[model samples]
Target: MKSLMKTALAAAVFITASNAVDLKVLITDTLKNNQNLKADRYYQEAKQKSFQSVRNIYNPKLTGGLNYNRLDLDVRNTQVVNTAAAFVKFSMDLYDGGKNRALKNQKLYEYKAQKYQNISNVNQTILNVVTLYFNLKTIKENIEVYKEKGRALKAQYERIKSKYDLKMATQEDVLKLKSEYEANLYTIEELKYQKMQLIKNIELYSGVKVSRLDTSVIPDTNVKYSTTSDIKALEENLKASEESINIAKSSKKPQLKIEDTLSYYRYSDYNEKLLSDLPDKQNQLNISLTFNIFDTSTKSKVESSKYIKLATASRLEFAKKQAKTDFELARQKLLTQKEKIKSLQSAVDMANSVYNTVKIKYENGLVDNITYLDALSKKIYYIALYKQAQNELQIIKMEYYLKSGIDYKKLLSLLK
Candidate 1:
């Protein structure tokens, strides 16, 4: 007996601990460990580095290498010569017709676009976590409702079976109650299976095992709107496209460059003696400007970039309109769920009253087993509906917040 009691105590403690988990904490952990988010962050960093790489055009580039050459003369009195040279070259682009500046801006805007895209991905991950968490919560509550109904049916079945043995109740009555009780148990099992599936899904998103979910509290339904990452990302893309036009135009202008080279040369004859008359060390500098006199490709590239910018601008406008539409729809859903929850609560109450009345009439032999069973079924159906509406209200509220561009953490704080 002591061992059994200890086991029960431990099981209760475990359940309580699991139920104590906060949804916000799970979301935080998920955001921290999500592989997709990590990949996006790395990609954003790479874009940032790419932008930095092209930001400075005046920086000088230095390179050094060694070269070896051997010449064999076929003519008379011509000796074989071997030459080895070590050379260092320094080069700088004095001007690129604003090409490098435009390139830098393009990279910078591309990085910004990626940065906002990462933010959007984070929001999506949070929504996934929240959705799964609430789904588990709803399933858990439904399981409890089924368990309660199962217990009530179990007692009613036992009572009917006793009455049948005494010939006071018909065999059909006993069989019907037994069937209902068994069905209730099956439903509970099915719900438990669904709960298990939901838990696994939560783990898939959060990278943490979920034994239970804490959703006794619901988030506030108040919604607010602000700029969303999706729109920001598109705006950056449009800016980058505008910069591409400048980059293309720069290609049509003059490009100037400066280069200097210092070299040490070693000359040797067939006998390997140094040729003293030949110059050994030399320095050379060159400054040149070049222009693409007339290029059909430059005009085509400029036109393509302008078209890209126009396309992006159209997409951005569509995104803004879509966001507005979604937000309004989410608000409508939230309000509908609120009304449904209120109506279902009243329905559950009425159904429970009707069930109590029918149950009393059946116990007194005033009503048939079918009526009693029907009332019980109606009561549980209403209860399930009420619970489902309550859960859906929370989900709708989250949807509303998401459309409003409110951060999930802020929404979590609003949860009572």
Candidate 2:
């Protein structure tokens, strides 16, 4: 009982560990190093500048100046235009109410929309990394498959050669098997080179030493792939677009602001200087309001916003229709691929059985070496065909999953 419990605990510990996935971890690492994400982060930080709306309040302007010339302390009848007077003027906004408020509100929504845009972009990046990783994995598996088949053919060819030397088989039979095995070997080499290229691509996307990393994740048959709900996604996108239109229109309304400033000024000569500690100092302050009432340009802006809103609505409807078509299309392709795989599997099994029978006949001296060699050739051909069918089916399945936005993490779990 104690031993059994310990074994169970060990199994549980292993199961609880996150599946060792080099590609997923590499993707996470790459996103951190992504220059685009870094730029988006900077954009997010810049959103803080919107707070200036509250502080840098636009105020009206003021003008003031003085001119003076001392009368000549000289001969009689000499007079100088000498006078000095200072005036303070102020202009303040009393009524163009709520325009600033609209501006600030629009900007707020714009910032939020940008945040969501970044989120959507990040999701796409994740998908891209995952798809590329799987493509490389598929090619790697092909290389292994070819290599294993090649080894089997090599063994069979050696057996045939020994039989031929013993005068039990024709030279033709021996040469044919040798040729097939050599072809398999050539295929293996080709696949190996292709696999090397895939590894290089993996390094390119991940920028990591994948040679030192864990194996990529593979899906198990036990897990299921769920199709995407296009209706739901389209609804969400439409809602976001609606918010965008609202943000655009918000720019048309009145806004609120408050601003205060302090500065020092110096002239060639001055009686009242802003920086001086003297009693008579010069400074000015005012408040103002701005309105965009008669601009014909805003009409164009409103039209564009309305058009975008309409366009989004239309696209959402079209997406619903397109989704239905795509779902059916994928369904048809999947069914076709499955049937093809099934037919090829059956053919391979029948050919294999026929080859075994021919082998028995040749051993009993009831059939020629040509018949036996032909059977084996046919069996091998069928096996290769079956493998190719499976590969094609796998690719189509992947496409279906991608199109439907199916999450395969549970599929990953089954591989363990």
Candidate achieving the largest TM-score? 1
Q: Give the per-residue Cα lDDT of candidate 1 at 146.
A: 84
Model 1: per-residue Cα lDDT over 1-416, one tens digit each: 99999999999988887766587788778888888888999999999999999989665799999999877674213443777999999999888988888899899999999998888888888777777777788788888888888888888888888888899888888888888888888998999999999888888777887765655455565566787889999999999999999989998889999999999988666443433356689999999999989877999999999999999999999999999889889888887888888889889999999999998998888999889889988988889888877777766677678888876567767764
Tell me how far the alpha carbon of residue 84 in candidate 2 is from the true structure, in angstroms, after superposition.
Answer: 16
Candidate 2 regions with alpha-carbon error over 4 angstroms: 1-137, 159-174, 211-279, 282-285, 289-296, 320-352, 358-416
C-alpha lDDT of residue 55 in model 1: 82
Give the per-residue Cα lDDT of candidate 1 at 240. 97
Question: How displaced is residue 196 in candidate 1, in Å?
Answer: 1.0
- List TM-scores for all candidates, in order: 0.90, 0.59
lDDT of 2 by residue, 1-416 (tens): 99999999999767545443465566676567666777877786676466344332233545454544454454223322233445554443333343344445545555555565565455555556666565556555666666656676677678778888899778887887778778878887887787677667656655665543344443423213233444444454555455545545545656433333333332323333342453233444545444456666666776776777688679778866776677568767978988988998899899989988987887677887668767876776677667666655655554555445454343233332
Report, for every candidate in turn, its global Cα lDDT versus the true structure: 0.84, 0.59
TM match of model 1 to true structure = 0.90
